[model samples]
Structure formats: C-alpha cells, structure tokens
Target: MITVKAPGKLYIAGEYAVLEPGHPALVVALDRFITVSITETQDQGTINSRQYLETNFHWRRRGDQMIFDNRDNPYHYILEAIRVVEALALEMGHTLRVFDLDINSQLEDQGGRKYGLGSSAAVTVATVKALIEFYQLPLNRLDIFKLAAIAHFNVQGNGSLGDIAASVFGGWIAFSTFDKDWLRTVLKNNTFSEIIASDWPGLKIELLRVPSELELLIGWTGSPASTSHLVDRITIAKFAQKQQYQNFLESSRRCVETMIKGIKAAEVNVIKDGIRLNRQLIKQLGVFSQVDIETPELAELCQIAEDYGGAAKSSGAGGGDCGIVLTDHSVDQARLISAWNQHQITTLPLTVFELTGANV
Candidate 1:
C-alpha cells in the first residue's frame, strides 16, 4: 500500500486579483491534511471515505479509463486525478493496475463542514501523490504540481491554482498564476508529458520564510462560501467594469508585493499595513462587483482581531468562511478568542505545515 498526505491552504493576501496571470498572492499550507492510501487489488477497485457515506465506491477499468459503478458520485476531483495520473503512467510505459483507495480528511469540522481550507485541492494532490508512488514514477515536486494542477483545473475550471501549489509545496509560498489561455494553446499541440515538462507562462511559486515573532490566527464564520460561484460573478463584473477591474488588479498587486517584502524582511508592521490596505481594497472590489466578498460575520471577525492589535482579513473568496489574523507574539490571544466566541465565531487552531527539506 502507498499512502500520501497533502495539506490544506489559506490565502494570506491577494484574493481575486490572483486570477490574473502574473499577479502575485500569498498562500500558506496548514497542518490539516487530506490522506490518500492505495493498495493493489486483483479484482475490481474500491474507494471508501467516511466523509461521503457508509458505502464504498467500486470501479472497473476499460483501457486505462476508470468507470465507476455509480456515475453520479461526488468524486469529480478524485476521479480526474486518477485519470491524469494514469495517463502519465501509461506514457511512461507502465501498465495500469486495479487498486483499492481510501481517503481521509482532517480539513473539515466534526459536522463535516469544510473550513474553506482548500480540501478539494488537498484531496486531489494526495490522490495524485499516492498514485505516483504506487506506480514508482520518476517525478519531482514540480512535476507532481503540474500534474495535479492539470487534474484540478480540468474540474474546477476557474480560479488560480494557488491552492494546488500550497498543497504540493507545503509551506508559505509567494505564488503567481499561469496563463490558462497559453496552457490551452500548448495542450492542443503537445503531449501530456511534453506539456508537463514545458514552461508554463507567467507561473511562479516561491517558498517564503515567516519571521519568528509572527503569529497566524484563523477564525471560522460558521458559513461556507462557494469560491467558484463568487469568482464567476467577479468575472462578469470585470467585463462590465474593465478599468475598475484593472485598477483593482494593480492595487492588489502592490499590496501583495508589499506583504511579500515584509515576509522576506521580517517586518511585522509593514506586513500589517499591507493586510489593512488589502482589507480596504477587497471592500472596494465588493462594492464595484456588487458581490458580498466579506459578510457581516467576517467583518466582525476582522474587527476583533484588529482591536487586539492583529492585522486581519477574509481568507479565501470570502462570502463567509475563514478569516486570517497576523500578529506579533505579544498579542492577547485568549482575549481575542473570547471576543470571537462572544460573536459566535470559532477560532481554528491551525499552524503552518512546512515540507521536510523543501528546495525553495
């Protein structure tokens, strides 16, 4: 059996703007993870997940394509992961094998509600990693990231693949999106392996070092938001308000760049200022886009953190999910948590997950 774990991610800065190619964002991998385990089987393959139900999903292979017994199951990411990895394996002169796979996730609450910590990306990365290990593929970290990105983009079809980068790299990362239009053009003229090996235009991923005194705090709003849905709405707004969207992109870029500089220079104040500016920028974006990027609960979450001298903002797409707080070690964490609880917000005890001997 081969087992692999991929950590969930949170966007620290650069939210909607990161969708544009070459625009930077800060994303960190959290300790919460999705685990995938696979073992060879002689008969039909099975997949079980308590997160889904008590039943197990069985599958059959028809010439390297997986055909599930239940076609309507909620395994789009998992199934696509299997297909992409198998395609690469076949290209490497390896025969596909039947395997029983198991998935377990720590990215959710007791009630099985996702914390918006990028569970879908984590699961997809874990599945791809497990399959790569099972087949003994000679792929490096970048190769794995590319393959997982391909599988993830095929399903989600929108948003920056920064979560996939965070899952694959497993640390604080400065990321820029790849040009999807360029990718589409390349895919039309290249093999899967060739495309994986090719340079993706505008893509960038750099691991960052957090200052010793910096502390990250996460708070849940008890409401989940659909990132794709929010992004779609923003896209429509972008088309209608071209100049406004362009201004947003420039401002977000500057804010994220400053934050990245602060991370590199170990300047907490600079980072905090960037976070504050980012909050306002996102508010302006919401006003123009006419989408509630930050809800009342999210505002409360950020306000409490700021009252405690911590810099805060909504983490992801942020109709209502988690908000992140960055502060020095001197802040009163207990008081902050108490304030959040009084407002019905749940503080998530999550820490950054760093890769062992990461190259970047």
Candidate 2:
C-alpha cells in the first residue's frame, strides 16, 4: 500500500483581493492533513472514506475508462482526480491498473464538521498525489498542483484556487490567483488536454520566508461558513458598486503588500498596522458590498486578540469559521488562546506545516 498526505491551508491576508488577477495573498499550510492510502485489490477497486463518504465506492472499468458502481458518490474530488489522471495516462498511451483507495483527513472530526482549513483542497491534492504515484507519472509538485486546480475548477466553477496552491506548496507562500480572463479565453479555445499541454501562464506562486519569532494563534468560532457561498455573494456585490469595490481592492492590495514586507522584515509594528487596516477595509467592503461577511462572534474574537496585543481577524470568508492572531512572542500566543477559551471559542493547536522531504 502507498500512502500520501497533503496539508490544509490558512489565509493570513488577501482573502477577497486574491480572487482578482495579479494580486498576491499570504497563505500558510497547517499541520492538519488529508491522507490517502492506496492498496491493490483482486476483483474490483474500492474507494472508502469513512471520514467523509461513510461507505466504500467500488470502481469498474468500461474499456479504457474507469466508472464507479454508484454514480452519486459524495467524494467528488477523489473521482475527479481519478478521471483526470486516467485521461492523461491514456493520452500518454499508458493504461492503468486499479486499486482500492482509503481516504482520511485530520482537518475534520468524525462528525463531519469542517474547520474551514481547506479540507476540500487538501483532499484534492492528496488524491492527485496518490494517483501520480500509482500511475508513475513524471510530474512535479507544481504539475500536480496544476492538475488539482483544473480538477477543482471542473467540479466547482468558481474559486481563486489559493487553497489549492497552499495545499501543493506547503508552508508559507505568496500566491496570485490564476488569470481568470486568460483562463476563460483558453477554455473557450482549447481542449482540457491541450490546455494542460503548455505552461500555465495565468498563475504565479512562490515560497515566502517567515520569521522564526512569529507565532500563529488560530481560534475556531464553532460555526462553519461556506466559502463558495461567501465568495459568490462578494462577487455579485463587487459588480453592484464597481467604483466603491475598486477602491476597497486598491487599499487591500496595499495592506497585503505591507503585511508581506512586515513578515519578511520581522517588524511587528508594520505587521500590526497592516492587520488593523486590512480588517477595517474588509469590514468596509462588507458595508459597501451589502454582504454580511463578518459576524458578531468574529468581531468579538478580533477585539479580544487586539486587547491582548495581537493582530487578529477572520481568516477566510468571515461569516464564521476561524480567525488568526499574529504575535511576535509565544507568550501572546498562549495568552490569546486562554482568553479566547474564556469566551467559548476553541483555539486550535496548529502550527505551520513546513515541507520536509516529501513530494506532493
């Protein structure tokens, strides 16, 4: 059996702005991961994910194509990965043998409650990794990332794919969303295989250096927000008042830029300033866009962190889920968690997931 794993992601800054082309966001991979275990079977192949699907999905081959016995399997990402890798392998004149897949994730509890830690992206990356290994495909981490991005886009029509990039690269990263305009145009002009044939020009991702003195305190609000729903609402709001949103975008870009520089330089003041302004701008965006992005609980969480001398804000879509506190000292990290616990918010025991000698 071969087992592969991919980490979940957290957004440090640049949530909505990163959706646009050419804008950069700070993303970090956390220790939580999705794991995929593949084992050879005799009669038929099975995909079992008790953590998610609660039942095994058996696979059958119809000529060169792989088909599932039950068509309505809940684990769509895993199915997408199989279909993608199978098509690519056939294109390369290589036929694949089947195997049973056992999938699990640390990003969610057995109750199926997500922490908003990019579990979907992690599963996608893990599935892609396991298939690449099984098929013996000559693909690098970046190649797998691209394949996962395409697979996810095929499943869900909208996303910046920042989580996909984070799941691929691991650790601290500066990521730009793929060029939506160019991608849309290419999709119109070329087939999926032909599009994957060339170097993707729409995306840019790189590793960023994080200071050793910094610490992250993640607090969960116990409410899961649907990111796609939040993103869809925000997109509609942006077009409703283009001028106002445009201004918000400009300020957001600058705030993220400053935060990046602050992390690089280990300047707490600069980082704090950026975090404060960024949260305020995001709040204003909610007002201008007429979307209830931030919740009262999240606001109280941020206020608590700020009172403890840490820069805190809602990490992702902001209706609920989790928030982060950036502090220069470990003492602040401990204190923030304690205070948040007092308010009934649980602090996740997570740290940055640095890629250490593993591919995919």
Tell me, by lDDT, which candidate is best. Answer: 1
Per-residue accuracy of model 2 over 1-360 as CA lDDT, tens digit each: 989999999998888988887777888999999999988777799988777754345577999999863322337878987888777777667777879999888987566777889877888889889888888888877778878887776776677898998998898888888866676687678765676766776477888877777778888888877777688889998889899888888888888888888878878778777878888888998888777767888898999999988888888778898888888763466677788889999888899988877453
In order, candidate lDDTs are: 0.89, 0.81
Top of the candidates by TM-score: 1
lDDT of 1: 0.89
Model 1 CA RMSD to the hidden true structure, in angstroms: 5.3
TM-score of each: 0.93, 0.90
Error of 1 at 260 (Å): 1.1
